[model samples]
Target: MQPSRPLDVVYDPLYTTSTSHNKYEGHKRRVVPNKRPISIKNNSGLVSGPERHKYFCRPVLPHLQAETPEVLYASAHDAANIMSISEDLSASTRSIGMQTMYRDSHAQTDPFSPEYVLPEGAVAPEIESLTNLRYRKGLPVTQAEIRMIEHNRKKKALKKVLPPMSDEASLNLRKRMMEAQEIMDLKFRENEIDEAHARRIEALQESLAEREKQSQAINSERMRRLEKTLMLEKEDANRRNQHDRIKELRKLANKRQRIQTILNQGSKKRDLIEEYADYASPVYAPQMRNGNLVRKSPVPEVQFKDHQLMTLDSIRELEKNLPPQIRTSPKNQFLKRAPLMKKSRDQMTMETHLLNVESAINKQHVQGEEKLPSSPYKGQYRAILQRPSTPNYAPQIAEAGSEVNALRLLQRLIRGRAVQNMMYEGKDRRAELIAELRESEEARRFLSSSFQVPAEETEITKSAFSHVEGEVVSELLDVLQKELIRNKEIAKVYDFAQKAAEDRHQREIEEGARRQLEDLARDRHDQIYCFVTDIHRSTANDYIDSIFEDAVEDLTYRDSVVQSIIMTKVIDPILNILEEENSEDTIVKDLVSSFLFPWVQKHHTQDQALLEKRKYTSAIQALLAKVSQSMRI
Candidate 1:
């Protein structure tokens, strides 16, 4: 069996190595790989190890694993190259591919060369069944076929061991499926019911809202009608009052003219009668009976004075007999007397009473504690007569002239010294003038000082004025300086007091205006809150947008809008968040006070809008609390 040339290592399943033991042969072969060197000279050979197997076969594993129809031709080609069994195979081999294969008995080349030496104790590796026959024959072998076979075996094994489902199990599964279907149906019905209920509620809300709008419209109409009626009535009353006032004025004017004419007529008639009596005859004098003037009474016992004795009949008789001038005289016109209408009579009586009462009061006031009749006048009188008088604490305002006079005095002194120098320009009168001014200054200082003078006549006056005008200058300067100092002190005090009073007045005015604005804002807040929040959930932004353009000039409206914004934008959102998070009344309030209060304080601080919103803090907080409580309920 030994060959002279190195031969291909043809695979043989029955071949044994020197280290292998064969029970059938009843011999234990000795491991002599190092000595024998398992080459072509030796018949026994070692089997290929995993390294050799992988190097030769796994390189073509992908090609071998192909199961496509094209792989059939390749396999035939490989088969023909190895076997050379048929012409068709040979033709297929040459045409489809150029690959070659070897049979078990065929010799190609020895993987181990003749000179190769095996290592000591080397043994042939056991054959892997994965590459058994196909590898030995140099045919294609792959894991894909082995895996398919393994999968089929596992499937059959599982099928043989697994048990079938029982009737009870099938029934239980069917029951679960039916229950699931019933649950789905029940959920669908509940959703439908909920949707229908929501629709009904929405419809009811719409109807109620419509009714409310109608009622509001009717009420507004009634209110407008009532207002219009009241306005007409007021106008009518005012017009009637104006008419009555005009009539009363006309009557007064006519009464005044009649009184004036009567007064002039009486005066003229008296003057004419006096002139006639003095120049004409003694008969012109008022004729009198035994104890009466001019006319006797119808009753013999009745006696009257000259004017009272004259009757209407006598005046008419005189009018007819007199000349035209005397006939038409105003005295004879009885209609031109004092006003005889009741209203005019009443007015005259009132005036006469007022004058009489005033005169009596003056007489009583002037008489000094003398007892007199009580005054009939019940109206208020100024017991302490009001007149313009100086205040007790009169401020002494500094006169402008005082400071100017002091400055002028200094100027005058300086001018005098300069003039003195000019008069003695090149002479030595400077020392004399200095001595004279010094003497005058010393005398003035001594007099102005708080030193007591002697009771006896002092000779101070003799040394007072060293020069002609020095005495006047020193005295006037002292007075002016004192006046200037006093004026400054007065001015300072007056300015401080005036500033204090002005500040106080300003504060009072500010406080009053603030109070009025707060009152207005509060009223506006109520109106806006009622209008904005009266309906269901809605924001103030929509309402604000509707009115913002039209009501730009209305500050109250703007303030109300700002307040509503604060409620909706700031207050409502925070309240809703707090409500959703925690519904407890106490917890909600605490959260509002802790979180919302500070937030509102920080954000609601634009000056004009701030005043509008800050005032409603308490109201808004209460509203928040109320809303939270409602949500909880």
Candidate 2:
């Protein structure tokens, strides 16, 4: 008989040994049955003293009983049949049968056989032979049964199994695998090259499109510049023409003045002499002598006809006689007595006065006394020529006529001189007046001509160009400013977005690390029930609280910074719009309010906290305040 191998056992007790021993001792002890005695004699094979006492003391069996041999045989056969049926059932189920079959097949092959060995002295043949034997045995099995057997065999074979290939063969196989991998890598590199070429082509097309747009913009700008230059040239030409016309008119005026001066100098002296001569000459001559009187006449007495003389005398006498009565009257006195009486009285008086004066005065007074004596004789001679008393009227009439003629001539000369002087003065004055009139007329003509190009039309044209240029300048300024602001905002937004993305990435990393720590803690708790208690009690709660607080503070700070940025970027622009509105800057205000505000609102949604902040509303309120203040200004 073979001795059985010793069994190995290990036991663990949680509590201390003393505590276990104390508990065991306190329990009531249970009694076990004593062993039954067996009788054997040492050499004769008889019962011994201790064995005889045990056998005699034991009861003996009574008389014989008959047994059925056939019954026993039948029982044995039935037991054998039952065992066979069980075997058949296990085989039909397939998994148990396949496992047994694979074991039997592998048992037939020697593990150390040459067929199971490899050339390099490694043991691939053993694994191969075992796998082959298992495969053959399992071929008739169902798919499920074969899978179960294969799984069991792989699990068993994995333990203490030799390497599948010899060392040299494995190196060659690895090299082939590496070559295949290199081929796949080369194919992938070719695909990447094609993709890069496509990208380059697309970039070039985009650049070409941009260049075309730039060329069009340059052309438009050049055309505008050319138009402006042409307009300036035209204006200069018109001004030059106006100046030339004015110069021509001045030259004509100088020529007219020179002609007028020549006419004045030639006419002056001749006119003065003619006026003096006309005054000096008389219409008739008067006769005059120097100082002496001479008598030149003989009296040829023309005798009147006798009848006429007598009749004259008679008539005188008759008239005297008839008018003696009437003579005394005022009307008839002169006709009646004048002739005869005057002659007689004159004769008497002459004789008496002559004698008396001659006597009274002596000769010197009458020195020519001799002449008095000759007076009688002189009667026969020519009666003392008594000069007929010439009347003084001729002198008076002559003086009056000369005075009148002189006055008339003087008046004529004065009038002529006045007329000539007036003509000379008027000629110069008229020239000037005409020149003034011509200038005024020309100015009027120019003004009238200018009206053909109405001021409103010219002004409208000018204003249209000015408005277009101003709009261009304003638009350019606006676009440039907007672009600058947009660029600045984009930079800020990019920075903010980058910061946010960074923060998110950092948070994800922290969360992943925290989860890993939590998993480690949980694993430690599962493995050793109390391992995590110190960490849980002392560090975890405080760390979580600090992290939450810090996160909130950082978010609040970021929000504040974003709000300030928005105020600088967006609020100020809005305030400008509002200010413009208050000043009645309609064009500017309309552009900003209508075009810019909506643009800003759309831009704010990207920031997490900024989106939640009521920044737009606050900015609008601030702008309104600014507008109100500006109105007061």
Q: Top model by TM-score, which number? A: 1
TM-score of each: 0.18, 0.16
lDDT of 2: 0.60
Instruction: Give each model's whole-structure lDDT.
Output: 0.60, 0.60
- Root-mean-square deviation of candidate 2: 57.7
1-633 in candidate 1: lDDT tens per residue?
Answer: 786542222233355555665443422233223374555485357456655554443123434532322222222235555465466565744554332444365744323211122233553222222222444453354564454445545544544554444788866765676576567557756866676656765675577679989999999999999999999999899779856865775575566556444434433223433544353432233334423254322222435577842799877776687788755646544555664896786677668656755765574465435433243232223133222232232233245568778899999999999998787874564778788889999979988772566634344544543554687788999999999999999999999999998678656655765688699999999999887776533556667766886677688788999999899999999989977888698786896799988877777665658677777997899999999999999
Which pairs clash (backbone N, Cα, C closer than 3 Å) in model 2? 323-327, 362-366, 363-366, 363-367, 364-367
lDDT of 2 by residue, 206-226 (tens): 675698799999999999999
The local lDDT score (0 to 100) that residue 345 gets in candidate 1 is: 68
| C-alpha RMSD between model 1 and the true structure | 52.8
For candidate 2, the clash count comes to 5
